[model samples]
Target: MAEIYRVAVHYGNDNGFVEYNLETKTIKVDLAHDEKRREAEEYLAKEHTIAVAQDGIRDFKDQKVNAAQDVESFKLALTRMWEAIDLHVDWSRPA
Candidate 1:
């Protein structure tokens, strides 16, 4: 089975929530009690930005791995990618 990761962020008195599925790459914004949906929209925008940034870093890391000329170089690239993934995941957590 494929592993799935999920995260959510909440905002405002209306209890607006935004859920992001990193494995499936989907965002679900729930603002049922919000009349204007401003909080939901903001959440969506922030999620989009985060996803784009993550993708960019992943692509760059992949390129570096692909260009690695030796086993040590490949391992170094993988280590760097792992560190990047850790930082990104940490930053995405709801506070």
Candidate 2:
């Protein structure tokens, strides 16, 4: 069964909670605010994506990843994807 999650967004700069009723079965986004929210949301989104992708790579490695041509290719692919996500990650306090 696909896991579904109910999420809530809370801002530390006086902004109240923003609830998003999303169906995990599909990709969804409900973010608000300008630079503040975008910064937080973008950072979180990229981080989560990288985490999920890394988890996949870990799974593949655990599955007896070998020196096959495709195995290396997959590793490279995950590395590039993770790097891309990291590039967009902004690690700074919200201003």
Candidate 3:
């Protein structure tokens, strides 16, 4: 299986890892790693802006639920999420 896309976000003392496999049209999420958890907590603690932190925390909170949806829907949600958090997304087509 080939992975076409993957991104990991650490925030609000939580970790969300997303990976998409092109061959299978499947997405996997991992949020239980100890290392990633530490990173997530560090990011939350180091964040200086309240608004940004709150937004990120909100997104992280829904990561698993959103990822459980259909692939296309999850893709859209992911794009919106990254955009909302000021993360750059270079789409193959218009996002």
Best by lDDT: 3
Q: Note the Cα lDDT for every prediction shown.
A: 0.34, 0.32, 0.45
Provide the global lDDT of candidate 3 against the true structure.
Answer: 0.45
**Model 2 misses residue 27 by how many Å?**
5.6
lDDT for position 54 in model 2: 39
What's the distance in Å from true for residue 14, model 1? 0.8
List of clashing residue pairs for candidate 2: none
For model 3, residues 1-95, the per-residue Cα lDDT tens digits are 46456666543545456555666656554556665444433332231212222355455332222332345544555555444443333354221
Q: Which stretches of candidate 1 lie over 4 Å from their true place?
A: 1-12, 34-39, 42-95
Which pairs in model 3 have colliding backbones?
A: none
**Model 2 Cα lDDT, one tens digit per residue, 1-95:** 44333233334333322222232322222435565455443433342222223355455332322111233322332233224332221113221
Off by over 4 Å in 2: 1-4, 13-31, 48-95
Per-residue accuracy of model 1 over 3-36 as CA lDDT, tens digit each: 3233333333333334344444444445555533
TM-score of each: 0.30, 0.26, 0.36
RMSD of each: 12.5, 11.9, 11.3
Q: How many residue pairs clash in each candidate at the backbone level? A: 0, 0, 0
Tell me the deviation in Å of residue 54 in model 1: 16
lDDT of 1 at 51: 19
Q: Quick one: ranking by lDDT, best first? A: 3, 1, 2
Ranked candidates, highest TM-score first: 3, 1, 2
